[model samples]
Target chain A: MNILLRHRIILPVVSLAVLLAATFYMQPRAMSYFGLNLLFNLAVPIALATIAQMMIIMVNDIDLSLGTFVSLAACVTATFLNDAPILGLAILLALILSYALLGAMIHAFELPAIVVTLGMSFVWGGLALFILPLPGGVSPGWLRALMTVKPPFAPMAVVAPIIIAAVTHLLIVRSGIGTVLRGVGGNARSVQRAGWPVIWLKALAYGLAGLFGVLAGMALVGLTTSADANIALRYTLLSIAGVILGGGEFTGGKVSPAGAVIGALTLTLAASFLSFMRLSPDWQIGAQGAILILVLTARLIFSRKGAGT
Target chain B: MTNSMMLFSAAGLALIAGLAEADTSGKRIALSNNYAGNSWRQAMLETFESTGKQAVADGVVAAADAYTTSENQATEQAAQIQNMILQGYDAIILNAASPTALNGAVKEACDAGVTVVSFDGIVTEPCAWRIAVDFAAMGREEVDYLATRLPDGGNLLEIRGLAGVFVDDEISKGIHEGVAEHSQFDIVGSVHGDWAQDVAQKAVAGILPSLPDIVGVVTQGGDGYGTAQAFRAADRPTPLIVLGNRQDELKWWAEQRDANGYETLSLSIAPGVASLAFWVAQQVLDGEDVAKELTVPFLKITQDTLDEALATTPEGSVANVTYSLEDAQQVIASAR
Candidate 1:
């Protein structure tokens, strides 16, 4: 039991399973391929956003600007990426570089990530509004087709998350560079002592986060086929919730790519389950909050029990 | 011309067109609403449900279920619309999250032979029929009323809605145009209220400290009561504020009238426009020659009708008028 509890992924996996079971019980149709596809299609961008948040969290820093940054990326994808591909790609690359520079600045100046990102949130939101002031821009065709692809065995919704989890897990959990990056988050002093450049590691983490954020935004526009300045503003809170739900802590490097993916899926399913129950809209949002609290409480109880033994 | 004149002409055409015998008993309709966070939206959902129940009982349709997204996000609403399509709803009445972001899902629903009718936050897809309020006219009329009330106008403060939204842009444009035409009133200050009372109060308070004595406040709907509150808090003489048809706004206006004979105009698109969209979707499904674009008249309350509107509107809700099938047909005829 202690070993199982110590395994960070188990809690998120169990929580996801329980929620999926409840959803299936309530609406058996959700078990089919088509129904599952419909239920989970929007989860793709959410999972990507969660993973992006996880990358920032892995470095023990919070990003309040992630939601607006994603919105800006989507705006870029819908406008520049559609009409002028080269300019769009260059802008996206510049955005990622800016994120890396931001990380470097934070580390060098010993600034609070929260305050910096909070200020940047407004900048990103303004830029997004400037890019697509009114919510009207056609997504590029290839991107749209890529997002809606249908494989034979499982739907793209399920397949996409699996691929995301697997690749991120391999890159962050198995590689040598992964060890150095985690070391920077776990103990920057010790990593610097060992001759690993802590500043570069933090920059790398933030740059990776930017990459995922861009992907999340592009995926969102592909699904909606257009962009709005405020389209993904809710993602900041959702991504933070996803990270915490997946057994990641606030001031530590402990994070699980698989657990975060499951957490995103669980959050998405919770919404689908509530819609299936057909609760009043007034209660629906409250019920969703209740579900989140229940899952977290269960995790707390199990962790306490595990510690006692 | 005023909306009443158009309605009178359309009523005659509707009677001559004769759309009473259409057969739509087997079709199922669904309301896909994006947000229900405010009093206005709550009133909208309630109106839709009550009107749907009546329609169902009269055998006008098989079902009229309403679904609102938890998060007011385009992605969530698109998914909801797709689910409605899968559930075999013959028609969908939508209050979209964004005008353009939901085009893909709406197009898919259209391809599946589902009739889509969008109102309030209407979609931009050509396949969907739109029931839009002439929001620009609503804004322009507010200034026009203020011009009549304060012929030699002083400084005015403009309270706008959520930024980056098309509705906000349109209304603000109209207000600016009205100012351009009137030339007496100068908009000295402007702030975004996000069409919420508390937000409006806070925004107005933030900007009022620097402005000169204002004679009027121009506002989008859902912000009038808040603007009044801010003026009271600032201890400034209350301005002749244009109001949205919220119960609280009307009630405040009434109290002010009793105390000081404050006369101002109140107008808003009725929350029951959802029912109009519903009936239009039904007409489309019933094989009626409904035009792709239709406009609903905004409800207006003047000093004379203030008491009547207040008595009819529920507390903490928006003023509303449920549209019957005849009203929908009249609107459709007028559009044609």
Candidate 2:
């Protein structure tokens, strides 16, 4: 909120500007159709997940179960609510409450997020499997229609993710907990010395990560019009990619929300570029793996260069 | 490491022969693919390039070239088209990105005297003939099986692949049309599995507790395992008449479930897409007058015929046998 804080957000803002500009330039035609469903629902959940990772990284922790949480939340939602609109609401609330409790447990005990979240993800995956033996549930056609029908300028998928990210970022920066998160990132030892509830802040961080998982799940469930446990698994790596791509670090340091957004868009663009090249599906996989590596290397190089200066 | 792994490992061995063909023969072929994220893509590529190599070895074509990429980007695939132009490939097979982005590249390929073939996936653009499978028709084929039996009517649960992918939409579209005339069947649930076993399993599990009177489940790919697991877990007898890809276990499960009083409507089809690709490749290469679109053989192997096919075939081959280069050449000649 302060002028100084705004200045700090500048680098990520600029990075996002560059990414959006490139996005416009690369797909001049898609510039107007800017809000496709894949972008909104499918893409946004991952973006928010990335932001959630950013918050955790700012505090020098990592949440490995973010993807698991999303997948599990989605699986539960579709299975329980496939027939009714209330299923969606019920699943969403259940996911948030369960994750919040888990986050509290993790932070209250001062457990390592890498360990805590990873274990939690496995638990969720197991739970999903136990619940759904086969992938054969019909979505309440209403939610599918709502998610698919793009609102005027762009599809709900694209806009919804952006809105979620914006709201999440506001909470991260403007709220009291947001300050503690930053403060914890700066010097958790000092924050603890200053008598802040360091444990609760970390717990809330995981809760935020859970929120990202559910949102991404919702979008994915909407995007694919079905939910799968493995879908979220891929984003685990991508979420990390998005976070690091956004210039965020996990070991309790600075994280730029804007950089995370730009990182996601850039990755999207890279994938699109591969499509334009008309490579084989086999080649596409290799190329995406290659490009993901390239982007990560680029991010690392830039981060190192920035650190050196 | 993966490159060497690809070379040293058998995972890409069938495709590697395709790379060798580029050098042995003078002509080059480039494959512009839309998305490589799914198993359907992998199985397709394995069958495609292997067949491409077989053709080149038999002197059916001058040379062969290949490229692979992901579905996330369209421009990069378009760029690959240009790359094919620079490389001077004799032909290009497009699985396509968005069906429209490749139009410019396809025209360029044709202009350069390079034949273009679209397979499995239709480019939606006007190009050389499309060697595509009739997904809509196939949907009817599967649905018809269920319809003729369920004259008295029953509940049907349809499981689809990726919502946006061509496979899911076209197949489901066919199902919608096929069941239109049939009055007895009601679609209970449609879950998106993206063609993964774990997903299929999870989806079936969610609905089992609620739907006690569910009749038949229509699925794509080898999803029988997922379905069976869900049924086993729920302490429900496996439905005898489930529709699925020809996995080995489906045969045993069907017999066992039937004995246990569950009517399973299951089929393990292999010669489905692989045969289509083989036929398409032959038709395109030999300049055959085959229909722009053709439907390959889809086996409806039930308990009666599962053993014979399994004995001669590999554990999970789509077809009883894969065609050699000579067979492909014949298919091509027959089309002409």
For each candidate, report its DockQ versus the true two-chain complex: 0.39, 0.06
Q: What is the TM-score of chain A alone in each candidate?
A: 0.96, 0.80
Model 2 residue A128 distance off true place after TM-score fit, in angstroms: 1.0
**Tens digit of per-residue lDDT, candidate 1, span A218-288:** 99898888999998898898898898888777775777777888888888888777777778777877997
Per-model TM against the reference: 0.79, 0.53
Every model: iRMSD: 1.9, 10.8
Indicate which candidate wins on TM-score.
Answer: 1
Candidate 1 displacement at residue B311 in angstroms: 4.6
Instruction: Tell me the whole-model lDDT of each prediction, alpha carbons only.
Output: 0.88, 0.60
Window of ten residues with lowest summed lDDT in model 2 chain B: B266-275
Range of the 10 consecutive residues with the lowest summed lDDT in candidate 2 chain A = A33-42
- Candidate 1: tens digits of C-alpha lDDT, residues B1-336: 689987787676566435433468889999999888887788899899999999899888899999998778887788778777657789999999999989878987897789999998989899999998887888898899889999998899999999987789999999999999899999999999999999999999999999999999999988999999999999999999999998889999999999999999999899889999988898888787888888888888999999999999988877888898878877887788
